[model samples]
Target: MTNSKDLAREIVEGTGTEVEKGRGPSQASQITALARERYELFMSEDGRPYGVKVDGANIALPLRGKAGLRSQLARIYTDAHDGSVPAQSALTDAMVVLEGVAQAADPRQPHVRVARGDGVLVVDLGDADGQCIVIGPDGWRREQRSPVLFRRSGAMKPLPLPLRDGDGLAKLRALLNTDEDGFRLLVAWLVAAFIPDLPHPVLTFRGEQGTGKSYSAKMVIGLVDPSGAPKRTAPRDIKSWATQAFNSWALCLDNVSIIPDWLSDALCRAVTGDGIVDRALYTDDDVVVLEFRRVLAMTTIDAGALAGDLAERLLTIELHTIPDRARREEAELDAAYSDAHAGILASLFDLLADVLRVLPDVQLTERPRMADFARVLAAVDKVKGWDTLESYKATARDAVADVLDGEPFAQAVVALVDRAGPGGIVLTASELLERVPAPDRLPKKWPKDPTRAGGQLKRLAPALRTIGIDVDDSKRGPKPKKQRLYHLTASADRRCETASPASPYDPETDSDQQEEGGRYRGDASGPPATRGDAGNARGDAALFVASPQDTGPDQHGYSRGDAGDAGDAEMHPLSVPAPRTHRTPGQDAEDAPQDARPTTPCARCSRAQWNAEGSPLCLDCRTAA
Candidate 1:
């Protein structure tokens, strides 16, 4: 018996001889020659080959054969790229061979067996216009070209929070607690900070030194994304960095002293959704629109000097001194707390992934300020049990106060006006005393003097202007003749009216009198009179005295008591021979009473006259007295 190797060699040799010898033989030989030629052509490619016997329609491939024979048979079975054969038939044959090979490979390797099919060997040119062949169990196949480029789809990984331990985060939470409005403000800040599409998001932690303002800011960084948070820097450096970074990122500026107004405005605009800065990236030559989405958490000892615009956008967190020893002791337990929450934090990432999965579809419709606030709430809500995020809505409202119409100066002007009262409307040198009590108390000579008080009022005008109150020249004059008077325009009055009644100067009927002296007085008896003339006094007194119906007895002393008596009194005049009054050389008779002995002519009347009514008081005196 011969071994399988010898048999394989014998078969391969016989097939080769028959194929060459019958190449151009006679009819009977021609038939055999055609058959052999066809067989040889079938096995013409590299790699394994298998022999298939075709008896009309029944096709059969050799399962067991010599090594060379089997190799040739495999190649014949897999010749899908051969041009001599019909394209469809060649692909069909190649697919069978590929399938067999796939079955022979180790089962451990991951493989999917494609079903046998026509044209399985065709290469897929993807979305581009091109052509090639890929052999598999299926025959050659062609893929349709795509018109546009394909892009991979997936969510972006969230920025990692820098804090590693629960303790650090807890401390941050505690620090934030110092500011009653911190949580909401911080959340809004983080939203603005992290959202690249939003503009300047400025979070200002303002308080006295050593109030943990810096610490509070750091805590916010830990809660947001730790990796992207930048260290505190000077205002100039912060401005430079903000202008350079293409994307939004958080910046904790610790211990900022005086931020330039321009920088503050820029930062405010950036955070409040309107900020845009010119930016040139390393990869790009031209400057492009660079916007900040980063939350700007700044720690400042003095916030008074902060830019008005910037200050308006900021969510101010005022830190107070920490006093509780127990709280301090808890703060000391940061390490243990972090260890406890490590697993929970890891789980939070999974939760965050879910949130990202849905966040893209959530519409943001808040106004710029409110939108910033909402974004923060959304971020915090992702953390379990942070439902209190709603509180930030109020903070959002408060932060926008400066930008709203007539906001900054509303209270100040109202207070100034209320203090000023009706007197404030017609401003005079004396009216300053009512508006500013202390200034008014300064010696009357001080603020009242045109050379002194005028300058002071001029200086104060700007401060008043800050609240939208204006001083104009009195309608009574021009230039040097112009006396300054404050007028509340209709617009200004509306502002004051709409403002909260809690305003420092909200007017009330029972309100305490602002000045020591009343604004108006009808009676000269009240105090030493300061204004009006004698004519006015006489008219005022007549109106006062005539109002009483029971005062008829008081009228009896008048000369015009009755028409009948008036004529008789005029004819005789002296009820008992008008008593003559005497006077010494130096004394005038007018100084003597009518009852006194007559001396000389009455000085007032220039008449030697006397009356029971003591009318030596001449016409002017009689009427006046």
Candidate 2:
């Protein structure tokens, strides 16, 4: 008689088919039964096979193909049977075949882990009971686990909670300041954090030292992670951003002096939920993971020149030092903070529920930055009977207005529009140059030459579009050259009609009629060429004898005297282009010497140097030198 162990050995050795002297046909049946009993294929509930494993510990290792399966089984054979080398080899091959047959018979076993991201709301409801709660823009419910990847990883320590009350609300309101637009923006940002996959705007806090930028950041961080601490240093670069994006739930860089270009690009990607591929730590293959679209905020004394696209994606919250500001530092506030946070959390849940309940019926005429958030606020109005949505819009509008006001070209546009008055005015390129005040007349950096001003106007079209201003080319009313018309309409109106090319700017026509006067002007010559370009010709023929101030680029990527941060290098339209090198009588194209260093004149002294070190200033002219 062939016992079960003997039959199993025979089957593993591939000798089950060969009948022994004492074994009958029944022994083959035993071998088949034992093979079926020894291995089973485990699968996930979602239908992913966890792969084949032995019956004992049932470990799922990455064993696929004949070579891999044989290798895996040879180890198992040695462990199970204490077999000799040749016997182990035969058993590995035999078990590989047997496991294949068994897997073919019954291929699936079940295992499951639940994870999901709602476009505007994500809550990690882990596989455990009584741990998390689920809320949405439409409704709310409590669950055992949280869906937030940052929260799930235990990166944050949530504060202990007590029953809610209205007492803490008043104090909290005073602390955050309900009247300030910055406070309102913070609330909107908090609401956005609960939203799942949408690109959330980066919240940048710019203020002088001791103005509570870091404190404000701590409050925001507490809302997201409850008891989390903000990382008080800037990330080194994009690679660091990539690594940190995966680790931190919400990144809050404090006192950032200069935002590197690469970090800005990475932040854009992180906001958009784009994936970044990096080489795995130990593996040769590249690991492509979803770029964590984590909530981002930063505190800076002076935010460096942000790329234009990045600027569009940022919500700047300017903090100021007040003489008699309310007293309560983070440490002093921590005593009441935990209970206050608990109340806020409870209120927040209630707010989310109300928003979701009325969301479908709420109507919004305009979508602004954080538009979806506005809709949520609209829902809050419908259900909570609060004027939250109106406040939200007002806050966002003012923030944008402030950004535009900071920009030199944008300010020039505003000045022109203000001059146009209630009915609006259309000015010809030449007329516009005559009417729009020069930098000396109004603010700074206004193009003095008509053609240079026209070029500035063209570059500023996108900025104008942001503020609901319209611009178009027209060849209206007996004009040989096309006139670029500025259509400044009531900001409440989003769309603007194109100006009539046939209707030229008439100091006589009503501003309302200007739109109807212009016929479509297609493919006409742009503003006439002027000496130098918009950059150098900014002082073409100064309207006044204004002395130019020499202020170097400060930490904010602007001259020290500027009201705010300068536009990014890529977005800075007025930066002078490199001077053209014209051949002299004795000069040839080949005569130009090639050198590793820049041939342009030094920024400081404006003198050309043959051996200038890589600095923007010549060696002697450099500040450090």
Candidate 3:
């Protein structure tokens, strides 16, 4: 009787000679019939199946035969044999055999299997042997892994600490520098990490040097995935973002000094599970094949580094560096971790359990910023009797206000509105340039030209929208140079519970104080009338008309008859005064028009001002004109 090895070798080496000689079945049939038996014998003998297995997922793909492994052995033998031709040939033959065997393996029959399905979070039920729960945010749950799962992936393996209540949790919270809002935000972030499909806001820790920004980030990240290390270099460009964030669970842009607009936009998408695409490296194909999502955190000395859209997707946490300039020793921190790591993890699991328990009847009355996170926190609050994450909502409101306030353009717009009073102001870009005072704090990149200024304001439209300001480009006239009208009003006081009672009526004052589309509607007609006598009006207060064509009371009902013209009107003035005109030396009097016609004695030599028509010019000036 032949042993199993001899039979297996005979089956592997057969060439159908026996069948052709009418002494046995066809080689293909013989191989197919004996393959399963050989696989069983092989596994029983070696105690290891010829297949691949991944940690999180439960499926295993089997090999048809061991030829691929033999090819690897052949290569090793060649290394030992000084690259001999025989060894190289053996490698080639082994590769061919492996390919044949893989093709011949039963495609429908899997050789190995695990107890659970592929997911981000896998929980052992523990009530009985092999009982488990697999959870994902995609609304899919299964007891078994899909037929195929990625063999190698950057997916994280979560390490959950055991559940218990103690001062250690409170101590860890203190160590992490998490207040009520910060703690809620941290919990939301953890939930988002487990539920990969949820949209999450990026947590930005900001403070001066010695702040525990990095420490807080690492400790929070370590609770879920201790192996995921924080990267100090933030992705400055789009390419870097795509390349660096692909396989990461949580990307920490530690000690970031500057955040470029591109990186900010990328982080916004990444925080919310949006895929960022990039071209595969070393490929001629122009296709963008790489896409992924990951949690993002950043430690910055300047909280104001990011602006506009990026600022909207952030939860800004200002960490006060430990007082007394005392830094906790690394060992002490580690020991703290060792003592409380399990309880903290248990708290997270407890949070998740609470969420799952109350998910059926959860009603969100208000969708706050980072609404998904807000909802989760609400669920936690419902179960735990917490304040329902009100602090976080307030923090979000303040973050938005800070971003608006920190931005010079936003500040300028706000200043213009404030100066306009409770009633908002509507002004074209040109008008804004002529009337609105420049913000005291200006950014280095502030646009100098009116054209560029208009573009910059338009770029800020989205950010302005978040603060209840509406920028309207629809007012564009037929001309390309016509400036868009930006309508800025007193941003609705989000913090106010009830609108302030209507102010006392003053019949003499402008009654159009009511906000229309968030703007104080002044007269709809045009620019205000010239102030302080046409000749005397100059600077921003003067009504500088184009071609002197609009030298009249503004359509908003302001007229020369009114003792206090609209120009003198407070914040809700009808219009901004035009610019003062300067005459060129030796310019003809005929060239100057209307209010702009110079009143100075030297006057234009050619044209005549209304009052200066009879006045005589010096002979030399006349001749030059």
Candidate 4:
């Protein structure tokens, strides 16, 4: 008799010849056909990974772990044949053939029990009946089965059956320990979570100890994705964090006390559309990708000063501690929430569908860091006749900061420039350090030496400019300009220190307290060519921005001025300035003429004082001369 190997090889190599030969169907064909009959295999939504659709189910089984698809197939064979399982050799041969089936399949974008389908929002109920809800311009209603393939994780729990008339939203809202503006933001975040393809903002809540931060987070997560584990402690590292991301649609870190550098970077990536990559196993070259644009939320008492990138992406909402008279037992709150859960979900769906109907007509003059999030919610605000976006912008604009509260280097730079007056100071890293040494209680991120100081300045230049401090690296000129120098001045609104164009802000005497931002937008009204890259650089400078490494010592870092050592600060800023023609760092009078760039005006020529109407002369110090 022929061995199973001979039959398997024949099956794989066969053409129409097998049928023409009119022989009995081979054992290999029978084994492979069982999988074909029981499952439908195809690529995932992004067209990079594969998943299996179990014959009569709404959920798609992932082709992830070593036995992800194989185990199910083994169970199927046993159940089909009177508790007699297939031989291990036969099962192995079948899986190899099934792999071929998967390779030849088409790509289908799988939804995580929530997706947009046929001009409506599709949310799988995750129930045993395979039911789902279709929400759109017409309204929301239940369907026998979801039209989209819902990718369910092992940890995913079913959503509450939505009640069209329930006051669930009001109940949930009353439970939140926030003000009206905060409530509006909370609702907006919930709506944005359901929308597809947009970059979602991180909905962060912080307050005193008894503010119900974790409880609020749990309630919010329940609205979209109700899981047995609603709130998780922040993961220790990026790898563990990525694992948490794969297991749920909504990721909530409860009462996080610290936002470490690695976690901060990862959260930013997740907020936007960046992927989380990890080793498939400890001993292999294989990888896993959780690249989906997911909904992110966090609760923190004080993560301390947030990183600039994180600040831009954060929709920070403050919660107040529950008054002793108002506080209720956890069991009471849970029982009431359970009663109202379905209605709240229904009301949210109703609002989202209405917003979707008018979403195309909504226009935002200013788009923030999470522009997509703004666009969708702006549409909601337009329909509701509310200024929810205005509230979001106000919060975001205030939070988009370069310097964390109490940062030594930035505070020192502010002081140094304040002392020198408007012209600012032109000096090297060491000189600047010598004159304006960091305070005794140096922050952890402060630079220890000149090398670190220069690096810190390079990173802080864009952020510093937000508060009206300009830093520039001057090019070597004639003999007088022997040392490469860094030119510091009160921001251009205050002086004619560097050769970049007039900044995009009020061209007048600014207030003493320079605000971090006036708007949460780039120049959306400006032409794309003129605006350049939509980077994190605050204000007009971001319109034409690049990465800090792209800027290097040549543009704004510590150059080897007068043969000094390199000094850089520890933490890089959230944004770097765009490349521009700066006054060749401390270029003397003649050097500017040779480069075809205008020379720096005399010390008296700055924004601090008015110049003579028709006179080329500017300095009040020189007016007497």
Give the best candidate by lDDT. 4
Question: Model 4, 419-499: lDDT tens per residue?
Answer: 444446566777667767666787788788887888878876755665567788764323864655677777555433222
Q: Candidate 3 residues 1-625, lDDT tens each?
A: 6566756665566432333244553333333333332332122111222322223232222232344334334344446447743334434444444445554444332211111234334543222122233544333233433433221122333344264767444756767654666665666567545545456677778777877788887877666444445545765567767756654556677887667777777787776655554544466764443345566777777666566667677767777657765678878887877778867766565566557567557779988657777777787778768764776666665667676776776676655554343334555667666654575765675776678778878877776666666666665533766646555554545212122222121223534322222222232122334232221122323443333344444544543323133443221333344544555788776786444554322222211113345644433455665
RMSD (CA, Å), each prediction:
27.9, 18.8, 14.3, 16.4
Worst lDDT run of 10 residues, candidate 1, spans 108-117
Error of 1 at 521 (Å): 10
Alpha-carbon error at 509 in model 3, in Å? 12
Question: Native-vs-model 3 lDDT?
Answer: 0.52
Candidate that would win on TM-score: 4
* Candidate numbers sorted by lDDT from highest down: 4, 3, 2, 1
Total backbone clashes of model 2? 25
lDDT of 2 by residue, 464-500 (tens): 6666666665525335654555444324242132322
Q: Which sequence of candidate numbers ranks them by TM-score, best first? A: 4, 3, 2, 1
- Model 1 has an lDDT value of 0.40
**Model 3 regions more than 4 Å off:** 1-168, 276-282, 286-288, 325-327, 437-444, 448-455, 465-468, 472-484, 492-625
- For each candidate in turn, the TM-score is 0.38, 0.51, 0.59, 0.71
Better of 1 and 4 by TM-score: 4
Q: Per-residue lDDT for 309 in model 4?
A: 65
